[model samples]
Target: MKMRKARTPIIGKLPLRKGTIGFRLFLYTEASKRSAEVKKYAKASRIIIYFIDRSPHLVTGNNIELISLQFLHRQSFTEKIEQLSEEYDILAIVGTVQFEYNDIPYFSLIDIFNDDHLKKLNSIICKDEPYSEMIQTLENHLTMVPSVSRLVQRLRKVIVNLELQLNVNLKEDIVIGMILHMAFLVENMKLQQPGRIFPNMEEYYNSHKEEIAKVKEVLKDIEIEYDIKLTDGEIAYICQMCLENQQL
Candidate 1:
């Protein structure tokens, strides 16, 4: 599908690309900043949800980077749709008002919660409803600054403590992924559960013992703050994130 001109109001009308990470839904709204509706879709889709202001033009600056870190594991670019709509490949514009254009789907907030609209949304994002348990956990952390920035600092601190260097892109991308991972870990701890067991964990642990030790040490602050112990599997998962982000 072809996109309208850059000057046009509606944007990101192109068809979904093969093997793309996921849709970047521009959720235009004049409501309160960080509404529950915005959080719901964002957590469900596990992708970037750019909250639009009253005007059609997009908001820019630090908020974009902050929000992007909140849902960064997918690696969605957070450029303003007005400037790079075509390249952004936005999935749709969902908001309280519906646009007249047919370039892309416009989902009204009124009917967005309806079963039919939700099914279409799922089809577009190529993911089923997020597990109910996980959604509850995400809602709890969605508004927490510590969940995004503090977790990022913890991971970056671990990298430095280990005397490792990571490229700029990987460093940013991995921090985003790690934030999401840690959120789930917190949830699991609340339920007296553990993260998924790593296969051949003994061998893997033997190979990366030093890295694992440092990761656990850095994560102690989070554990203390949340009053929850970190399971061995959780430590392994975090170690893998650090390793993947390391510049070899």
Candidate 2:
């Protein structure tokens, strides 16, 4: 799609492209002072967020880098559109009022600016109803701060695709729940949360060794890619989750 002029009260719509990321978020702001809370929502929602600059060529001056590495991410006017062109999709405006044109889910961001807003954002990001599509969304959307990255999200896509290719019969809810639990487990492990070890979990791990091993093998690349190790406990927990729900 070509770059078109953005009318007043409009965030520039991203050009439609092949393989655009699932969601793109634009934050309307005065000058360049954007709330840090917006970034949190972006990562959790796995949506790219742009701090719409007052000047066309303004650049963000902060250390929020890794999360903003993609298009619609904070950048100068010069590089922003180029990066946006490379990645993004149907532009949706989110703010304080419900001014929507066409079919975009426009909302007033001010209305949902608290924890409630984050919850709303998460729901929007995972709007796909089918289990398969939800799996894809979870893959793109799961982010637990400095712990999880695009690498982990990408791993979700690869794993889900491989499972389908292998003809693994799994329900949508199970996959969705599994992804949420697994992501939570990893995040908790990274934080060294209490009760990290499951009681008698070792026995379960031993009995399901083969299944656990397979998952570990499949996830070996994630370890390398993210430079993080899944502790035996975390692996055991995941194995228990995956094995209990299916005849793997």
Candidate 3:
């Protein structure tokens, strides 16, 4: 008798686009004069400069490619912050050297934007910041091995917890928000343990088979909501093998 196998369900692929990730740097300077020098070296595919003051605001154009040295230190940091309330296609934040202010640090705001741009924003911001090494380590973990199943499971848990804590229903925004938040959390985690050994693709999969299977189930339910269909059986096979290996 042929053994009946579970028919793997087909689901849609998660959308990923450039600029989905972003980094926000808070540089600490005695005054705008000293901060100007640091800003001069900043470069990326996209760039923005803002002063961190009572209210943050954008001082540079959205399309500018290179860091605007002229805009640096021209206005007080407080003035730049005022502009932060305005929305942009890309992520925005006041440039600063200090990571914290008055004993309060900025919480991870990765959930603020769409997925396609979020990753790109994270990469550009991290590369240009003083914490480049730290950021690099974080990136390494996030990019180490792509296990969509594990990623989906972990993300689901995070979004659920976030919803509970915030007392706000973010069901509509959970998927994209979770992806960005996971990237940031992973980055920050690696920064805390630069020498940490990130789980290998095989290892991660083997350890999380059950969780991954559940993710597959969820994906089937939400397949239509995504932009691409993920009907690849190979991916599911790999995830299963990883989980099986972990048990041995």
Instruction: For model 2, give the RMSD to the true fold.
Output: 18.6
lDDT, candidate 2, 1-248, per-residue tens? 12233221222243333332334444332122355755554453332233223311111221111112222333453265345434443233454323322223343445334444333333333433454454455556555434243323443443443242233444446666766665655555446665357679768777877777766765665555444577777767666655456534
Ranking by TM-score: 2, 1, 3
Q: In candidate 1, what are the lDDT values of residues 87-192, reduced to their tens digit? A: 4444455554344221345566654555444444433343312322344555676543334333333333333333222211234345445656776676678667
TM-scores of the candidates in the order shown: 0.37, 0.38, 0.20
Local distance difference test, candidate 2 = 0.43
Model 1 — which ten-residue stretch has the worst lDDT?
A: 60-69
Q: Write the per-residue lDDT of candidate 3 for residues 1-248, one digit (tens) a residue.
A: 12122122221122223333222233222223565554443531123322222112211111212212123443554444434212211122223332222111222332323343333233223322233333345445565323333333334433333332222343233334445544444434334533223346457557656655554543442233222233334235423332333311
In model 1, which runs have C-alpha deviations exceeding 4 angstroms?
1-169
Error of 1 at 62 (Å): 9.4
How much is 228 displaced in model 3, in angstroms?
36
Residue 4 alpha-carbon offset, candidate 2, angstroms? 29
The CA lDDT at 41 in model 2 is 49
Point to the candidate with the largest lDDT: 1
